[model samples]
Target: MILYIEQEILLDTQCQDLYLCNNGLNNEYLLISSSNQCSCKKVQAIFCKYDHDSCKNRCLLEEHLLIKRKKQTNSILINDSPANVVLLNKNELEKNSEIVFICHENNLPSPILEHLKNLINDRSNATPNPSLHQTLIGNFLLKHSVLAQSAYGMYLKLQQTRDNKFQLRRHANIGYLLANILLGFLCSFILYRNFDLYQLISNEILIQTENLTTSIKSIIEWLMHAPAGLKLNQPLVDFLARFYFYHIYLWSGYLEVLVVTVVPYFYKILFILCLLGISLAIGAICDFIRLLTIHLYCFYIYAARLFNWQIRLLIILFRLFCGKKQNPLRNNRLDSHLCDIDQLFIVTLSFTIFLFLLPSIFMYYAVFTSIWTITILTVKLIQSMNQFLLQIPIYEFYLWSTGSGIIRGTPRLSINYADSTEDTVCYNFNFDPVSFITLYRVCNIRLSLFSLSFSKLFLGILKGKSIV
Candidate 1:
């Protein structure tokens, strides 16, 4: 195998030649080789050595003398040179190295300096040039550090700006949410009280009854004034009379009863009122809770967010329980405005303090009026039921009991004949006060229909046709 050996020549004084072997330590030889011939007298006093390891014994000169001779020859060539300019940057200053040529024609030209400029430019164009800028070389690696610091500063500023924007948005959302909750609370409170119940019941009874009566009266008077004299059934006349009397009496009696009984028993009445009162309060609270939830369904003009329909339904139901119609206003605006719970409480309190608060001396009489109205209605219902039983006669088996009677399902599964024999049965339904009101309302409707139908039939017979 053959080995490739490389060697380099440098102008250091201690060594003439330095050789590098791929697998061996460096070797120095004390032989001085030059391209030009050397004169013997020029560096003869300097000691010389020609110590190539192959010729170490043959040469007698010292290594330092040969190095000095070689350097002097190179110096002669450099000092005798006619280069006009030299590269003075780091490597060039140290080793007098060449750089790329720039022609004198490319700069200012003078004939006296032309030859020197050409020689300098030629030498500059040679290979193995030196760098002229030392500071740039020393500082090149620090560029990335400055850039990284600038980037980090910008990032911190952006982060702070984003955080501030987020805080502002959160604050605005909280304010809007709070405002909505307060508004819902106010609206729901108004819906709780039934301000229009009494007005509605009274107006409905008066208007409808008057219309019905006037229609009946017109028919009766027309028949009475007919050219031919007429006759009608006696029992039909009696039924008509009884029906008219009962409903009219009951209509008038309701006011007296509510005024006398409910005013005195204000605590019990207040309880009934508060049932809807606080329920609406709860609905308002539910709306507030729902506002915070992601679902926005409860917040709107026609919905729970604006006015909860559930509370309105409850108020209507409670009024029906108190024997009143769902609609109590002739004027639509009054119905909407006056039906609110805040209005109801105001009216109820005002009436309680001002109208119903007469002296105790007249208090018993007021209560007596309520009891008398109840007695009249009860008697009319019993009389109607008796008339019904006489006609239908199938429910004679229904046994009588107190207010605690079982009512919903089949209640008479096991009844002994001995316990069942009684001329009149008394069944009490007192659990819900509304049950009594509903019972009476049913009786009133039946009595009114029976009376109107019988009256029309009687008048038809009297006129011999077309009474309705």
Candidate 2:
């Protein structure tokens, strides 16, 4: 059978008697051609001519051809004859165009076509199944590997479609900011009106301050004795104890004055902070804690400076003993030098004195260093928590959870083979909910700031720099 589909209608070259029949009900035109008797009685060959002009109406023609072909196919099947089904593009039929055969149905009962279709179907529907080993190792790598996270992040970024407009995000941010401001004002108003609540807070601060002062005094006295059952030079220990105790007394006197003066106005300061924002108020509280522990910080600095100075002198004396001197003109590089017997004696004596004094200096440095570190970490932890609260996208998460369409993600396409037959396939499109990982990355939190490097901390302390 030979078929020519055109804009108006077309006639077969062999059988010019073919007629064009238009169905009045559906307003569709069908070309009805008479079958020609051929030499191959069992085999039927069909030829089709498609034009560029009719390409726009390909869907309609395709449907009509399928219906007509089905009817002829049923008859051929009844007769147990061989047949072939082919679809060609208009470009392929033109001069210098390539000839392509879409499908060839033979009566030899070949399973190649069925096998190929099954393979394609299975591939399309395949889901990943990781082995137990792979699952465990992959999870570990993902958590600990920076490269893995970066690669996954890049893959997600590529999957996401670019959308420059951020009206929804902007609106959400504005709403959150307004809500925060309103809540801050309400809190400030409540605190300002409630006198007893602020008075209690003030009393609590004074009590904590007094307790801190008493604790410091007791710790100093304990150290003056053999702390941790270690023997120490009594005269040096007593001198250091008296030094710390004097500072503690001074700090206590200062706190006593502050309790009568500045501490009474603590609530007023809190009210002012609350008016700014809850996050600001939290930050202010952290700052207040640091301020209260300023004496500890000062003690740490003094101990670190004294220890570093002693260390520097001992290093110089050791170099003198090694017959080497630091060349100040050459960036403090070591240079060989011959020292006299007198110089050697003086270097050895100084080195011994400094080394013996190191135990007392180290003891004070360690104690104050620990106290300062604890105070700093507590303040930093509070600040980090405040920052996390401020940066978290709670509103966005709520919108996504509610399916409000405010948060959009990439749409995934799925093929629905249930509605599909041998001739046509159906496609379904849907969108998956945005992942929490994506939301977290969007926030860009600086978690690395909290990461500690012990080497860097030790170097900084040796260099007489502030650790905090």
Candidate 3:
């Protein structure tokens, strides 16, 4: 079934035996008297060269030619043309010979895979090399962001493949997200009944609804002093920031409720673990969900013109009821200064930039929890260990501040704070991961949004400075 693609044969890729090969690899130089496959001098000047780089280019050119031939004629030509194609051997290698494949080797045409089962499926059940797995998993995790991924996540990322599929696939994101969401709901239900023991000790004052409303009012008032010529949609900015805060506050409130209830020490520990898991799951789902939400928001904003009178009426009524200010840029067609499509594009770009810089809060929480718990236990062990272990601090904690420098920062997220008067700035690390997550989220969005001052002022509405 060897597809010695010497003659101009359109790849009726219906056959699995079809493969592309070149005569140049079998010889030091490739020569062609026929001009049907491009001119001989064109081949002599470049294609015939005994260089790996040149051969790669030649193979590409050959594939291109084959594709072109396929288009001109749909049938695979069976005549012998000019080729010294060798056998499909992986082991045979010349001093500088290399093979290039244009087709997807993992997934041949349906019938073809069946025919080449012996050749392709031979390594199906073979155990992957431990070192190779380690190398790949290590590189992938480090490349993405190590602080945001748990050890179990790392294991799944390194798991063996099925049906010879690639280790890297985009669909995995969808499944990972769905699993997290499902797990969150499951935990919520399970905790509701069997988990009555989460209450421990907490009497701290949580942010009240009245406080949130006051903050919003003050924030809007402070925006007037924002840099002039800023084109921010003040209402939108305030809304987004408030919404982000609300989500954080919701999670914090739940945690607060849990802390105030009474529970045993073992249940308390179990609750902490479950709490961390839920947070991590939420963090994992955030990226994809956020991306999706952004697009949906953009779609709504950009596609407002498509809405009939009923939807438009509802929106107008809702705005009136909520006391929303009339947007000067409102338009049924293009916006006052920006088209809907253009605005959507700009929104997407800004969101993408922000997302890239923001660290996963849940992942960070998991790591922090693990480290804090380990430190608590390890310190006790150190007290009994030899002098080497005794040298380390036990039953204590330390504090440090971050400066406005690239190499230094509290969360290491950013150094561009609104107030830069302080020589060194240290953020308070909250005992509650939820509260800390709130702070982290605020800092990241604020810094990132400000950094985009040169771009759109979409979120620059700060008529009041009293929000904090």
Candidate 4:
């Protein structure tokens, strides 16, 4: 029997040709299997270090476990738990799904096994559950939502298993990516801080300030000796020069004074706070711009369908004649375009147009990109500080026995002889990290919506766009 394979064109050559069993008869199986393997050479190399059994067993095992976990996860009774798992992040979903691990415990008392299930059934409805973010860390021992939910699911599976509790724990990679990002951010900041970028900005501003001050002094001298008729005729230029000299002088000199004079004295307290605020504001502005641009891109895509006829016609015309076929490198007319355009031509055209129009965007883009990079460094530093210096334990439920309550012999369960430890109990666990991620994401979205509404209200009032 023949097999049919369907795939779209890839823009990059890095992940194109690498595959196992290039002409195997089991083409379907190969396709299914290879879908799970990393196409990137770098990722495969990383995978090879820990993946024994020639990566075959690991790849096969990953698919088998993920499928079983998905079945188990879907079979779960949503009505009983009613965990609202809202998935907004693509990375979180993929990463969390790949992290399903199985754990088993044998030789346990019946009550202990049963109690474990009960613990899983009960969620922490505690009032003081806190976020571990450095900006929002509280006094309470806050468990990460993913970890907490995983523990809960594991407890539930333990009760359902036939012999013993078999736990499926999905915590793949275990925050290594986030940790690496934090590390990289730190390294970049250390390198950048050594470069003294802020000193450069301050210095540049000082030089311009000095030059402008000198020019203003010359202008004033020229004006002092000039005729009243010429001064009247050039009153606008005189006013602007004087106004700019005072205004720009204050802005340029203040930072210089702060950095050159008072910063050494109050570096830790006042100056640092000022810098941090300025940095945060700049980062937030950059992020806002990025978000807005992305929103506009989405809007542009939808505008093809949603916009009025005149606008729609213009967009379609631009897209249709983008002329992907014009490239001599292209083999056929069917060869796809880059984002619906001829990449080489569009890029050159965009560069030309950017130079002529909206060049301010490019100027701000470079400055903000650097500032945001530093802000990310600050964020990483804060996250690391919280992780290292601050010890926030994951809150867990523990059982205690009372001295007054006397207990009889331990409870036991009779099973088949094949199942050894007949008078013993066992436990199974299944921890679905996805559920906790979804829950946290949902809460975060709600929080974001609330904050957005509040900010919009405040901004409207400030702009005199709404009720006082």
Most accurate candidate by lDDT: 2
What is the lDDT, from 0 to 100, of the residue 139 in candidate 4? Answer: 16
Q: Whole-model lDDT, candidate 3?
A: 0.30
Model 2 stretches astray by more than 4 angstroms: 1-165, 168-172, 175-179, 404-431, 443-455, 458-464
Model 3 C-alpha lDDT per residue in residues 69-149, reported as the tens digit of each score? 122232222221232221111211110010001122343322222222322334433434434226776656433321233
- Give the Cα error of residue 380 in candidate 3, in Å: 39
For residues 168-229, write the lDDT of model 4, one tens digit per residue.
11111112222323444554455345544445544664675567456545644454343333
Ten residues in sequence with the least summed lDDT for candidate 3? 93-102
Indicate whether candidate 1 or candidate 2 has the larger TM-score.
2
- TM-score for every candidate vs. truth? 0.15, 0.59, 0.21, 0.23
lDDT scores of the candidates, listed in order: 0.28, 0.52, 0.30, 0.29
Collision pairs in model 2: none
lDDT of 2 by residue, 174-283 (tens): 44444445666888988877856855766787798889888878888878888788777789889988888898888877766765676557667768767766655665
lDDT of 1 by residue, 319-354 (tens): 533445444455422222234676566545654443
